[model samples]
Target: MNTTKRPIVTGIDGSGEALDAVRWAGRAARLRDVPLEIVHALDFPALLAGGVVPPPEEMKDTLRAHGQRYLRAAQEIAEAQGTTAVTTRLDPDRAAQALIEASRTAALVVVGSGGRGRLTGLLAGSVASAVGAHAACDVVVVRGDSWDDPEVADRPVVAGIDGSEPSARILAAAVAEARARKTRLVVVHASADEPRPETEPHLDPQAATEAGEQLLGELTGEHEAGGITVERVVVRGHPRRELIERSATAQLVVLGDRGRGGFPGLLLGSTGQALLHNAACPVYLVRTVS
Candidate 1:
């Protein structure tokens, strides 16, 4: 598949949060001049409690109607977000599975922080986590009140790096995002307890902090292009905790899928579950290694 031809896909479950994802994805697609795809999933597996293949025709029609309604509303929201080319789909597969499959040809996959309706797991947090873990492309779990906060519009875009995963791609994405938002970029390398590398037997706390700061500067210096202000932050705290705290004042938070520090592995494992659930803004995740 051609990377430039891929669409930005978002899955909705008739929830307000899912609509929020649509709004975000729509703006993103417009910015990149790509198509925005809005999807609604009818999770029929849960409806098979009666031990039947599809339950019944009436039930299937009702589910389809609901899905169509949600997709219609999502389409309106995306269009209002200034997305010129918009498309929609009603998938019969499970929410996680459908989104994961769609991700195969998508540039990005998006989902809400949660859902409230029965059979509307498309917006559920678990579904978001699943997609984040297994999606073929980068994932963004739409969370927090950053969208509704008036002051958050000017917040910087944050990128968390542990120096474990490949920082180049993560830094590049953060720079692009900050440039698009016309905001500053904050590159953070946090250490919970000023921990040192296991291979180094004599490294002290001060040395560790120095090392982290040096790494942060060296990794981000090359990415300080596009006239966007870039700031380096090396704080003493858990990476996840620091990142989540910083997220409160950020428009977007970017992280690698796997690493050490507080970011041992987000989406890949439960290491970053707290950060995902409590992020104050949209969390954009990218796999460090393809």
Candidate 2:
């Protein structure tokens, strides 16, 4: 299916944070003019654990009822985002694995930053980590940490690029999001060790900066020329540290699946996992054909 038509799917485990994710997913669905799917996983395995005899069938009904109740609540939030095309699912699977399955046909999979397993009892913090690590399409781990702060509502959408070819996709996606939010795009390129070709014994700092600037300029020209304002930054520091700081004021942080600036790995690397857990705003992990 065309990505534009694919639903924006979010997993809800009845946690407040999961509700927050539903809100975020609803807005994204409205933005993309697509459907919103709120899924609740009926994790019997989790509930079944530490129990000897099988629970009564009535208990099963209670769990299903709880799942439906959570789904109803999530639907309300999504609808409030002005999305009329909203759907809900009650899946019988583990939380993380269920969302990952939904992601196969979803345009985007959204989850809350952290939550203790409560009513549904499927857990989200760890689920967020797992889904963020394995989702097939783009993934958004919505962090309630700073997204609700009025201070960050107008901040730019910051993107971390490892200065690789795929990094441009991150730039493009970031610009598109920034444009949608009527904000600027901050393209950040930072590394603990300044990226230098092994063949070059001595890399000129000035030349490196100039090259970084040129590459960023070339990459951003299309987006900037289209009227999306951008700020390109290159720093000689740990990409994770720089991005985590910027995430404090960013509307969203965009990174690639194979994103690694100079670090051994980015989102798939050390920076990827760090930012996922630490970024103040939502972290978008892009990994699709586009």
Candidate 3:
């Protein structure tokens, strides 16, 4: 009934990871003074293909009844947070498509990784990864096992910046979050090892370091509003490894899927994908759209 707009939308499937996403989304909405929109996409094709389909209408009260349960659960989460919330159901052939569409207008979109229908060894759920890769806004993918941790609290918000426009966006968002939460903001620029002797035309080490510093200055200058403190670091190593290693002590680690001079649709490179699998905490990917 609440038609008001919120800043975040999280996909719910009653999974533990989805629940963690709900909790984090609640915290984010609270911090930003915005409502949370919880969405549950009912992919009829997926359900049918997975052999999880319900009985025919002759035996069912209504098709929407199934969707109502997820919506009701999402509403309960909002009530627990003491904020307004909206629940919407999308009937798409694919769950990922529905989530991507919903994220187009949201400030943040959240989804869970590895669910009932997931394949083994898949670090991220296909739908969640797809949404994270292509969404117009920020996307959060919650780890299922970490949801039960009782001590989960807002720690320093960390972001990876490396002289790229997308990295700039990540840095700005991290600063805003740090300011709002009164927490430290850590900006890390992680570089991979120099290409092996076998590889040709690798990145120059000196140039990379210089570029990193200039990128840091650009971001720092833009956020020099007074009062909020910022921390910057330049580490030489693989980006995803460094980010995940740093995330061991951070509450939220923000990174961009696409780097400078890269196409926007690619969420994370091989390095980012590696980190997403092993990160101890929640990892957020801010998608950059041209």
Candidate 4:
């Protein structure tokens, strides 16, 4: 029933990481010139014992108070970052479900890698993983040391390319982000093998490099008119390893949710998950909605 217009929505749970996510989302909203919605979802199942019966009035009030505190803190953080267009919501649902619903009307959904939860040992908590895999729009998981370092903003935005349609979609999103940040875009393509013999075996290594250059140009030609600096890179190595290393010095790493090599029914590809777990910057997953 929440028919709010598209905005940048971030999930916060009052933890340091969640607040970090809030700060990142706030800056992103400012860059995009859109409103920021800070959301805190009350754990409905944790509140009740067995049935769907509502808790006592006192308990309900306590939960409401806690949610409000988190919302206020997040709102203050966003405001301090100069994101004046900010709103707060306290949804009585699970964190992942609340964020999933918000994604339906959100230009982007941001969340911390981990937050207040029982599974603290995981690199990414259940809520983060669920939303990352299922959000309707692009999802950003705020993690790694570079995410909190102010100097990282000066770095370029890195885009992983595999010549797939999904990769093209992610490249478009990455270009927009780089343009908004007034930073350069690094387009990287990594492959472990030579050009497939069945496809383009006639092309030598130098020619293959030229092909990569041409492909990058074609993929980003439209955006070049916008004055965005782009660097084209072609590396012969494992795509996942190469991308993870490239992400170490980048401001943000963008990748398609699934690439050509992804399993038939997988929502998130293996390479995407590897980067999500190991990237040294915030990872943006751009999924094509079917």
The best candidate in terms of TM-score = 4
Ranking by lDDT: 4, 1, 2, 3
Worst 10 residues of 1 by lDDT: 262-271
The lDDT leader among the candidates is 4
**Distance (Å) between predicted and true CA of 103, model 3?**
1.4
Model 1 alpha-carbon drift over 4 Å, by segment: 1-4, 49-52, 117-124, 193-202, 261-271
> Candidates ranked by TM-score, best first?
4, 1, 2, 3
- Pairs that clash in candidate 1: 192-237
Q: What TM-score goes with each of the models?
A: 0.89, 0.87, 0.82, 0.90
lDDT of 1 at 64: 96
Error of 2 at 101 (Å): 0.4
Better of 1 and 4 by TM-score: 4
Pitting candidate 1 against candidate 3, the one with the higher TM-score is 1
Clash count of each predicted structure: 1, 5, 2, 0
lDDT of 3 by residue, 1-290 (tens): 23355468888776767777777787777777776777766665544534876545543334357667867886777667655554456453456787778777888887776565788888877777777677788887775354335544546778887666566677777887778767778888875542445544565777777777777877787676655767878777877778778877777777777655354345555545655677777777876664
RMSD of 1: 3.3
Model 2 scores worst on lDDT over the 10 consecutive residues at 259-268
Which pairs clash (backbone N, Cα, C closer than 3 Å) in model 3? Answer: 191-237, 257-267
Off by over 4 Å in 3: 1-6, 47-55, 58-63, 88-93, 144-154, 193-211, 224-226, 261-267
RMSD to truth, every model: 3.3, 3.8, 3.9, 3.2
